[model samples]
Target: MLGGGGSFRGGQDFFGRNNSNSISRSNKLIKSPFDNSNIPPFPSSTATATADQPIFRPSMDTDPDPEHSFFEPASTSPFTKSPWSSHFNSDALPSPADNTSFLPNILMGSLVREEGHIYSLAASRDLLYTGSDSKNIRVWKNHKEFSGFKSNSGLVKSIVIGGGKIFTGHQDGKVRVWKISSRDPSVHKRVGTLPTLGDYIKCSMRPSNYVEGRRRRNLWIKHFDAISSLSLSEDQAFLYSASWDKTFKVWRVSDSKCLESIEAHEDAVNTLVSSIDGMVYTGSADGSVKVWRRELQGKGTKHFFSQTLVKQECAVTALAVNDDATFVYCGSSDGVVNFWEREKSLSHGGVLRGHKLAILCLATAGHLLLSGSADMGICVWQRIASDHFCLSVLTGHTGPVKCLAVEKDNEVSEGERRWIVYSGSLDKSVKMWRVSEQPPSTFQRSPSFIPECSPTAGLLVNAPSFVIREQ
Candidate 1:
């Protein structure tokens, strides 16, 4: 079940950290509707609070009641659309830019390029795959560029790289699988194509259509109306597909059969991920996030329990699970990033507030969280010794950053482990950032590292190609 609500107001203490009297007093001082003078600055000098600390007070009046909230009427008002689109008309606010003041010796890089905006990104091993609006999926190995992989007839919406294969969801209502081999970089082949119901019918009616006389198998699952996103289980046994039809379908990959289809969301299920413990987390355009867990019985039957974890003020756009599987991070349409810890009951671990526009993507490794936002910036947050989170904002992209992939490199230096963050943006390029150090105190942006683009910078002009072979 999913919930809906008003526009997101970042740094406004939605959890009610401040006293009610102080909140009332501050609200009265700000007269204009657009005035932000009422919002109090986050305390800079306070010590970090423990996870058990009651930092936020859930509002009984405004908070969605679990029983009644799921049945509430969907908002159709144009004014109440996603908050991310609302703030786009206005100038984006700049985040703190001084990297030296917060963390020192941090480096950033740029890797991939495309003619259009990047929609989704996934990385496995040493390879990176980026799905873009250019109707091509590009592969990057090491720091060098490789050939683009073609996917669906329409724009490539999302991609996931795992099991030595690349899975892509397209706007044309088709999912494509490509097999990649390192031995041959110049050749990539598409192995399978899973088309939607209508497309399947069309292909069925016209039987003899291939120039190569090769039949492409369509792993069509009838339940998913329009595939929005996909995720594979830790063991790669189950494939989870979220759809615009507001349901999530779990398919056993061995048989390509739909095992279960749950009404998991109200709006489009835009993002989904699975933990190693068999927990599936989904985010939707309905402004809510839900967690699904499979309940196995002695009778060899499995049941799923879907629960709403956090109801936000805007649609949740992205989700990532930590390596430890202790926390789940979600990025929302309001530019707010939330961390939820696994416990007897799910609880909000912390909130990172800085992005001026909607957060587009989030990736986590170790204790670090990397987030890309529609504001054309990437922010890095590190959990410190005192349980407080430190922030480092990276700025370079001129357009909205749509996706991010993290690569762990252990062979670079002795006991020197680092994450290479690959960010895809609407500015039509992929930028990289290396997070090396944590700030001793608060963060301050350095003036010397301002990002400026050259006039002759080229975008990715290569065609999308995928290696296809008979299964």
Candidate 2:
């Protein structure tokens, strides 16, 4: 945890011995949070730690007597009255920007866009997808707008990209699928939807009279509530959609078929993370983290309920798994990040504490665990071999940070790798941040901290289109 007397503790000689020290710190190596069979000491303001021993403290106070209960509650349902209002033409598409004029004074390395209430964001090899609370879902490349699509029914809550397709989860209880048309790259088609039920039979992508008829018959196969989040399998062959209806349904990506539905939690399923090897992780408002497995048995497939992590009684708000599948982060409404490990059953690692409110989103880039909170702040933590601790605190957004995505690229000028952070907030904008090795402030202006050239130094010029308008 970052301390009260917070002083920025980073910056070093670029390409010098001093860089070694910063790398060790950035690695965030430290003692487990649960050191002596108790909650390990929270990273004080004075020090930081790393991810090792997979130490997570199981809070006796947070975990009440547990029972096998997967029932759904009506009061806390994700299917409550939706705010979706149909307004735009279903046939009309988003037009290209009038010009490629760059936003004035646009921080070269850091970008801030004025897109509305950017709820969800995704990135492919070169293109970026921005999902807004409004009707538009914009696509950008090299920081310039490429194309966009719109949905009049609901706010886009979650998005995932795979297999040349974009899957979006909307508050209107629908999963919309899109693809860049082969015939027209500039035009993206609403290729398909999940649980199409009758729509599958209608053989049409757009809404039609049969939509309602198919919807009625699809109740059993579709999510009956708001889709909170979506995840794709390692091979992108399977797609998972979790809902406020306390259930998560599995779909076959090749055909948009609803394969299975599991009543996951007693409360709403808020977030989920998936591993490439058929491991599905789900966190719910019921304060539990359950693991599910999807496997193929010859020609047939199956989803097996695997394990559960009930470290706290607070709602599990966000989740992240490390790239190597060694550590699993389960963030709760009470501002705790619980760690888990693989190996058949889970290893109770320890909890990470810093946020004043619920943790809303998490992204693990290299050894850095970036956490966004309802407190309108993002905390960057380092995880090296053992020294784990907080590295920086970013404060600017007026609203809660809801989503985060990270992209890494080589910084040719700095001779190192740089991480560009893309954050989506209820504030209706997407902000970009550059994290790289830099020289100490006292010596000289570090090219990593702030560019000496244009604000887009350190290889941000290579970032895909969509620069922010200057304030």
Give RMSD to native, each candidate: 19.6, 18.9
Which lDDT tens digits does candidate 1 get at residues 11-66?
22322232222122233211111112123322221212235331211111232211
Q: Alpha carbon lDDT of residue 61, candidate 2? A: 18
- What TM-score, to 2 decimals, does candidate 2 have? 0.66
Worst 10 residues of 1 by lDDT: 65-74
Q: Compute each candidate's TM-score over C-alphas.
A: 0.64, 0.66
Worst 10 residues of 2 by lDDT: 1-10
Scored by Cα lDDT, where does model 2 land?
A: 0.57
Predicted structure 1, TM vs. truth: 0.64
lDDT of 2 at 260: 77
Task: Please provide, for model 2 over 1-471, each residue's C-alpha lDDT reduced to its tens digit, 9 standing for 90 to 100.
Answer: 000000011121111112222222233212111111122222121111124211111111112212111112222334331111011121232122312421111113222333356668787766777776654676656554455677653667788888988888886678888777786565676766776756445544434322222125234466766777888877788888887666788888998877777878766677877875678888865657898887788976888998787734455667888777767777665666767666535777656666776677888877777788767677765554422345445665666677887777443244444466777765554566654322112222224432112211222223332222222
